[model samples]
Target: MGKRKRNERIGALIKILSHQPNTVFTLNYFSEAFEAAKSSISEDIVIAKKMLEELHLGTIETIAGAAGGVKYVPLVTPERAGFFLEKVCKKLEDPQRIMPGGFIYMTDIISSPSMVETMGEILASQFLNQEIDYVITMETKGIPIALMTAKALNVPLVIVRKNSKVTEGSTVSINYLSGSSNRIQTMSLSRRALKEGAKVLIVDDFMKAGGTAKGMMDLINEFKGEVQGIGVLIATREPEDKVVEHYTPLLYLEEVDVKNRRIIIAPNPKITTKI
Candidate 1:
């Protein structure tokens, strides 16, 4: 193979760092990839880290000692996160999303692994400093993103279920007003699912009335656990005039005129929601 140029080395380093965000890299690892001496790769890393910091995209962390390695940490600026989410929101406007009552059916986005992974990381970044002992979500559609967010935060995932089975062992259940419908619905959790006072980060795939999210919050409180943050992949405009207290969303679909084959996709304002 031809000897790679300096720019090639830099690009490769950046690419690796981007994929494994917040992961440490050893000088030896870079030396092996570039087939260059440790000193040469070290010089390259210094320049690469500087460039990434200059762009305000990532953090290059240095470590000392035998087990020490460099890590690239992604900091998604609000502007960049807004741009990414706006594009994603536009994808939901497909005429095929027209379901009953003019509801935009977005099962695909919720179930997609790539989209879930990206959205999960963005939310995780925001709560990186919090005491996120666990990630919580309700069953059915919210499981994937909850699991992914849990993986990102390296925390346990607690799932709230619609009904409990004897096979599920002991569980704690609670009731709350559903945001989707003004009626009350009950949600359950397996006993011992979360340690007492654990700081839980609540996540869900979609939000309309936020009834389910609120239900999960009530359930978490029943366990005597603390909720550190709340996240949703998509937040739909409430058909009913109502609002929830605290939450963050990647994107918002303000309008979907499937009748006219038009749609409005926007970056959700950084939610002033925290609990």
Candidate 2:
């Protein structure tokens, strides 16, 4: 086959890298695919990496040694992350978003594919350098963000159901106090959902008191899996004593006034500090 042009090779390389986020590929793979030399491919990768960094598109990481290769890691800078979340904050400020219990209605934003994808990229980037085996989240609302995060990390997504289902086969269940309601609630997971000794990153759409997140950590422990990290798309600022100590929340619900129909939200400081 005729030698491919430098532009053609770079475009193809970017496409391949973007499609397989957090997956490593050897230089030989690209060289052989494009019928080019290793050195030439290396130069192409350098150029591609520079462009990606300059544009704040993403990052390309190189691992050394014969067993290692280069991988693409998705990133959303603090400035961009803050800007995007600010837009969501504005949308949520509307009085119509206020619910009966002082909860802001965020179903529409959480369900939006574009919004979830962006937040997922930001959340997943935090755990990319770690040994993450699976992405776990409670079923329903959290599923979308968790699924997207798992996609970015190239890992499996596990759902912890609110109610046990016969279709899931044998399952493990646990009871935990509801942080917001001050009541008991039950959550369950399939016995086969995660393998023993796996490291899991928990994702959730909203966290009020973090009782549910704490329960998820307990469930992982029961299965002999390690809790690698916890992430919430949005969390309440009040009731600061979260049962789960460590977590990265994209946005924080600072204040909500039902009578005035007012809501205050901002990017979580953890997003800037951690990511």
Candidate 3:
């Protein structure tokens, strides 16, 4: 093929791989679709992979064998991730962010599409190798972040609603005590939403005592789904005994002194949550 034609083919390949991160596409599939030699397709992938890495866009992996091919994995570099988390912490420090009932007002940040997308990319990279079947989150505040994570992982997003909805058809509902409030609440999920024995990743905006995360684990069990991993945007400090033991929180709310209007937050040391 001509130089221009080859370039067009390479550009199109990148688009396909990027759009379907974590999904492997057999080299034969690309060669057949492009009507080009396998060798040419391999060369194009090499170029695309290099460009993606240099730009910090993402990385591509080449799988071998009959079922092997290439797959893209989205990621946010440690430096960029640290910068974004610090900025978020600074925003949280605003005294106005302190709301009634000792809660931090974070509706604006979690709802921001751009911010949530970046958070999702960072968190998704952590679970890329887990082989998750779906990204699960609660119906309300966690949906935006979860949706973006699902997009990056190329998986379906499943929502656990606070109550059973008539539009969801038959549902599996469970009642659990709220870890933070000690109040009993109900959470429901559509029975048809997930496949039996599927692996699910749980994502949430905030975690306090992990009542909701534990509840999610129970809900997933109803569908015979396994909880592969869990991720949270922020975790409160007082709840030292969180029901869910394993989770990667981007930031920890170490201290929230309502009287002094002081809020101390720190990044997760295990991961590059902050600088």
Instruction: Please give, for residues 1-275, the per-residue lDDT of candidate 1 as tens digits.
Output: 24456788778888887666556789888777787778887888899888877776756777889889887766555666666676676687667778767677777887889887767777877887787888999888988888877766667788888888787899888887887668887889888788887889999887888888877877888878888878888777755444567787777768877668666757667722222
Give each model's clash number. Answer: 1, 0, 0
Local accuracy by lDDT, each model: 0.77, 0.89, 0.89
lDDT string for model 3 (1-275, tens) is 23336788888888888888788999888888888889999999999889888988888899999889999888777766787888889998898888877788999999999999988998897887788999999979999999999999999999999989999999999998789889999999988899999999999999989999999999999888899999999988776988999998888999888998888887666567334
lDDT score, candidate 3, position 160: 90
lDDT (tens digit, per residue) of candidate 2 on 170-245: 9999998878889999999999999999999999999989998999999999999999999889888878988888
* Best-to-worst ranking by lDDT: 2, 3, 1
Instruction: List where candidate 2 sits over 4 angstroms from the true fold.
Output: 1-3, 273-275
Please report the TM-score between candidate 1 and the true structure. 0.74
User: What residue runs in model 1 are displaced by over 4 Å at the alpha carbon?
Assistant: 1-74, 239-243, 258-261, 271-275
TM-score of each: 0.74, 0.94, 0.91
